[model samples]
Target: MDVWKLNLRHLRSVAMTVRLGNLKAVAKKINLSQPAVTQSIIKIEEWFGAQFFVRHPSGMHPTEFANVLSPRIEMALNLIGSNRVTSTQARAFLSLSKTGSYVAASRDIGISQPSLHRNVADLQSVLNFKLVEPRGRGIALTPKGISVARKFLLARLQLEAGFSEIYALLGKETGHISIGAMPLSRASLLPSVLVAFQKRHPHITISVVEGGHGELIEPVRDGHLDIIIGAIREHPIGKDLIQIPLFTDQPVVIGRKDHPLTKVFEKNACCQNSQIMKLAHYPWYMPGKGAPINVVWRELFNRVPVDIPNIPIMGGSVMMIRQLLLETDGLTLLSPDQVAVELEADWLVQICTVPEWMQRDIGITYRTNWHPTRAQSYLLELLNHHSRK
Candidate 1:
């Protein structure tokens, strides 16, 4: 189903009918005439090609389809937080927010510019709030408008999930899982899990976006991505996100196989503070400040009485880090699992392991209100299973 094409009022009426079990009560609650409510229900049923309610002398009895769809509809309505918002308004505003100009939005959605402007203006008037403001030649959504747009996007996702669930119950697997993958997961975790999941459920499409936490978190929160997998921050991530810890990973300081530190570490099996202090003399390749590994690297130097080494290069790309380590006399902190192949191939060597307390909690992060469909839930289970091993 094209969720953007759905009439918001009709969808709400269907959800209300499922809750109230009678057309009259649904009409009273939504401020529509009983006949209007009945027509709304009929239109939705016809569009969906399924009967949601079975009429009886007593009241309307919801069908299995209604049982599967109503909760999702209600959840979507709550996320949108307004009944006055028409589907056209939503479609227009979403396009404008994404494209950042009326002309672009109109071109993107195949709507006339004047009509798109009127629809957004009408929506703003109905909601009693300014949704967009002039930004140079383009436009930008106000903070409230951005919030509303995110809710609308998530609501659309909810409706899509409902149809996907219905299709699944009818023996057709149809849905997509979009994942935000951090560097560590891309290297050591996600490949195996994705392979196994695709082998089992080939009909369900999966896409992964690789990025660092800072780049991925906002998209996941705004429903652009389903979940993010990698190291969990030690600080609080706020109430809107839920973190599920998969495993603890101990990081080690690594350098090229023939680097000076490798010879020093080999001579002294036990790493003394002086031996650790020698790291301060070498240039470091590290992630940006405040990343988990960066924090550990700083603390490692703090334990000794040496100034933290200067990070000449700062990034989260393992490929870049590996190449830099081989080409320069530099060192980096990373999980051994992340560079297992390089270590085995004698390209890199672990100079020393960080303290147990510096071990990282690797996991998954998703929106707090996210409810996974059966297939998504199965994928999470597979991630947990593989991470454990």
Candidate 2:
């Protein structure tokens, strides 16, 4: 169901009916006439093609569908944080906030610019807050507007989840999980889990968006992504986000198969300080600063009292780093799992493993308040099972 098209007032009435258990009470609570509340319930039930309330002589009793969907509706209403905001106003402001221009928002939403402006203005008037302001060419949201937008997006996610759960209850598989994948997760961990998950739940849709942690964190926080998989951060991020460690990935120094370091490791079983110092002469390829591997590289060289190797390229692209390693005498610190194919193909060789203390925790990050549907929970279970293997 396209949740944005549904009336917020009707949905709120549904939630209130679940709580109050009678149309008269629900109508009084929401300031609607009893017949209007009855009509609202009828409309919602018709839209879903299911009965939410079982009418009785005593009062209206909720059916199983209502029991499953009511909590989600409540959560969504709480996130929206207002009783006066209509679905049209929410849609209009969200469109404007996303496109950042009245003209573009109108074009995207298929409404005239004046109508879009009026809708947004009505929204701001109801909330009594400044949402947008004129920029050089377009408009920008105020800080308060951005916060409200995040909450509205989260509310939308909740409504979608509610309907998806309803579909599941009716023996329909229609859940979606959006993932933000970092470089390490993309190589093997995520693919294996996804394959296993798809086999078990073929109808569920899975989307994997690849990017660095810095680029993906905000989207996940804003409900655009369900979760992010990668190396866990060293310090505390905040209470709003939670991390689950799936496994620990040890860092390894890697180079092209025929590089000079391959010969150095061939003769020595253990890498000593001298062997480590030998790495100072070659150009290095590291991920951008603050990456787990980059931090380990800095620590490894800092302990040797040798000048840090010059880094010619800094990025998180494993393919690009592999090509650079094969073309030049450049070494990189990375998880061996990230380049398993290259190692198997004899294109790259692990020169030495970093100390066990240097191992980083690889895992999943998600919002603290997120309530995963059954399908999402199943995928997370698959990820944990595959990561352990």
Candidate 3:
């Protein structure tokens, strides 16, 4: 199932084969020829951009991706019950789910209630499942029907983007790109690049979402995000991701303008081991688990191979650290670029010298198999240019 070949049939076929564990059994159950089932499985592989099944002499087995996604997707598809659905039916089903009543849906769609009900009934017939239940003056989707609606809605969004991209490629207009912004990129690089990009491609809609690594990473894996950009880890990022290194942001210990350390550094202007060891005396602000800044903090300890004395505050809240440091003598390790505003205003001063090894690799990560369209490629190049500068 390449771009054009992807359809409900192929999706259902692969799902059934995974559940039944053999091509022959799946074909018999679905009443399709074995050769047809084989082609459907292949189509599913192409659509998913990965092989989801392993064929052996004994039987067929689901791959790891299949094992993970199969249950969730299967639950959704089971509501439809079969693969026979038209675009009109899909649209009506989707819209009906939203409006929740044939009268309201018909009014919104600018059609008669009878016509809307007929269309929904047609969809129900094609799916071989009852999708809605009337209660009071409105209706609600069944549990399985809600699952089906969710899957189709996701598919519709993908199709909308796909068609928009196709239109752009064919010299028509309209497109949308979803980009995930990580902590570092959100501060400067991503915003600067997006401004430049919007100037060039004004009609292409761009949506930017922000979160930490744990929150952002899985959305890209599930095809909900086009790309994620930020200060990245050098160690193994998951197998599903392809990270492109853009820049290196060094981590420096920073404190308030009038802190004791700033006064001491101003007089001495040196980062001797003795001065570094004195960091234990002052209050410390530690990075949270799994943050890129945490990695840089860990690198500091790994190189020095010693434990610091005081760690009263340990979390990843930027505002809290900024205020606490401004009011007290607490210290924190962070990428200089993240606080460029504070640095430029002289509100925050660097205390310890950042070592050469204490840098986070800033970059973009996308799904490994994703091939960008013209709009996406243009943004990627813009990011590349900004990161280099």
Which residue pairs in candidate 2 have backbone atoms (N, alpha carbon, C) closer than 3 angstroms, thus clashing? none
Task: Write out the backbone clash pairs for model 1.
Answer: none
Query: So what's the TM-score on candidate 2?
Result: 0.96
Our model 3 lands, by Cα RMSD against the true structure, at 10.6
**Which ranges in model 2 have alpha carbons more than 4 Å from their true place?**
267-270
What are the Cα lDDT values of the candidates? 0.88, 0.88, 0.73
lDDT by residue for model 3 over 1-389, one digit each (tens)? 12223556665677787788988899898789999988977876664466678989888898765654455445444433455675556667777888888877877667687877887898788767798998889999998678777666655545455445545544564777888887678878988998999998888888898777778887777567888888676778878789988988877788888888765665424455566666756887766657867766655654565565466787666667787788888888876777888988989888876667666688899877565656788899999899888
Best TM-score goes to which candidate?
Answer: 2
**For residues 1-389, what per-residue lDDT tens digits would candidate 2 score against the true structure?**
56888898888888899999988989889999999999998988998888999999888899988988889999998998889898888888888989999999999888899999999999889889999999999999999999989999899899999999888888886878999999999989899899889997898888999998888889999999999999989888889899999999877888898998786675324456787788888999888887877887788878877888999888889899999999999998888888998999989988876677788899999999899988898989998999889
Q: For model 2, where is the 10-residue window of minimal lDDT?
A: 263-272
**Residue 5's C-alpha lDDT in candidate 2?**
83
**How do the residues 82-165 of candidate 1 rate in per-residue lDDT, one tens digit apiece?**
788888998899889999999999999999999999999998998899999999999989999999899989998899898887
TM-score of each: 0.94, 0.96, 0.63
Per-residue error at 111 for model 3, in Å? 12
